[model samples]
Target: MESGFGTRRRTRLFDDLLALFLAEGFSQFTLDDIAAALHCSKSTLYTLAASKDDLVRRVTVHFFKRATAAVETTLSRNDDPRERVAAYLTAVGAELAVASEVFMADLNAFPPAREVYEANTAAAATRVRQLIEEGVDAGAFRAVNASFAGDLIATMMVRIQQRDVGKATGLSDAEAYTELATLLTNGLRT
Candidate 1:
């Protein structure tokens, strides 16, 4: 049985580690590097995971799980379909705001972590498709080709997540997401 206090402490530690990964990336980081980034000794991190790979997997899964929950929460907050769409995109942007190009590249390079990210993207696309369907049904959005639109949105998001796009476009992930929300709402609104 885990203590309530212990659970919160662990969650906080995980979040701290996740922030490090988002800022610095996982693939290139050694346990010693992690400890230095975390301002702790190597032994202090051992309690979290046996190896760096396991730590990366654990933190990656935990972060994505939290991010998905956050998106769902954002979607639930507003009843208006347009606002829901905006919130969903904005939430995604917010989540990736701290992530750097190196982090994004390393995440994609790691197979387990990449799989988790790809799977989540697919799930998010399904949700976006559903939102578009609902909006069209309500007549608040233009009757566009929902399936194709959904896939396009998903692809756009994946590309945006990549570092090259940001470097080429000179827009931060958050800036890109803001523009995306605007583009979606304006294009979809009737």
Candidate 2:
């Protein structure tokens, strides 16, 4: 098992490295570049993460964890399934809007990050399924296969949100949320 200090140190190193990768673009960075960015030797980074692949995984996990926490907080505030779902989507939009451009750029540059990204997305879909199932049980939503519909809804919302972000569609976040809520409510209405 890792000691607390060791874990903390690794966490800090990972955070620093991730920030640098986001800022500098990961595809172009060599280990020496990372070391220079962190003001440390290459060996130090190797001590914390085995390779660049591991570093990307750790960074992707860290980012998605933060996103998941935010969604959880949004869900906890509303008991109504529709409201909770809306809040969750709004939270996601807000996150994407506020996310550093460098982060987006880096994500586009790193193909290896896709697996981690997909895993995070799947986890969010599962949460949405749980919420949908609860709503159905309470007669708030139509009786449906909560898992399948949830996955579909989650995938659609993510794609639309990404498109909006990439295109800078000029839609306000509130407008986007309202549009998504309307679409979802129509589909899920009893």
Candidate 3:
């Protein structure tokens, strides 16, 4: 069984790997490169995953898991429904802004990594839909079809994740998310 120290060490390693991937992306890095970058043996990385592809997938999952918690924490701090919407999205944008363009491109290119992002997007859409419903019920927002609004936002989010928004509007995913929050709040305001 792994001791507490071993578990902590592994967690720290995962955090380090995630940071490296967020800054530089994983597609270009081999096991040797990652090991060298992390100042650990290849065996150390294998303790986290059997292969580099698995490591990348695990790191992507770690990124989203941490990001979701942060976004939720930001939303919880806002009492107003409108503020909650903006705060949630803005927090998401802030979390995503840490990732470089190369990282975004690499995430899009890798099917496994992209699937993790896609799942998170879907979950975020659901959360946004719930937030919209809360605003409408509380009369904080003008009456709007919450489902439709959520779907629209989700479509834009998917486009941003896929790099279509970047290609067409030259806005990074983070920028697009910020714009989305602004547009959504303005459009829904009573």
TM-score order of candidates, top first:
3, 1, 2
lDDT of each: 0.82, 0.69, 0.92
Candidate with top TM-score is: 3
Q: Tell me, what's the RMSD of every candidate?
A: 2.4, 3.6, 0.9
Q: Residues 27-84, candidate 1, lDDT per residue (tens digit)?
A: 8789998888878788868878888888888898888899889878877888997677
lDDT string, candidate 2, 1-190, tens digits = 9899989988888778766755655767788888888898988888866998777777777767777788788778887875666667667656545445656656655666756666665666676677778878888887898878886877765554344534566554335555665677678877
- The total of clashing pairs for model 2 equals 0
lDDT of 3 by residue, 1-190 (tens): 9999999998899999998998998899999999999999999999999999899999999999999999998888889987778888888899999999999999999999999999999999899989999999999999999999999988988998889999999998898899999999999999
Candidate scoring better on lDDT of 1 and 2:
1
Tell me the spans in candidate 2 whose CA falls farther than 4 Å from its real position.
142-148, 157-182, 185-190
Q: Residue 16 CA error for candidate 2 (Å)?
A: 2.1
Instruction: Supply the TM-score for candidate 3.
Output: 0.97
Residue 148, model 1: lDDT of 89
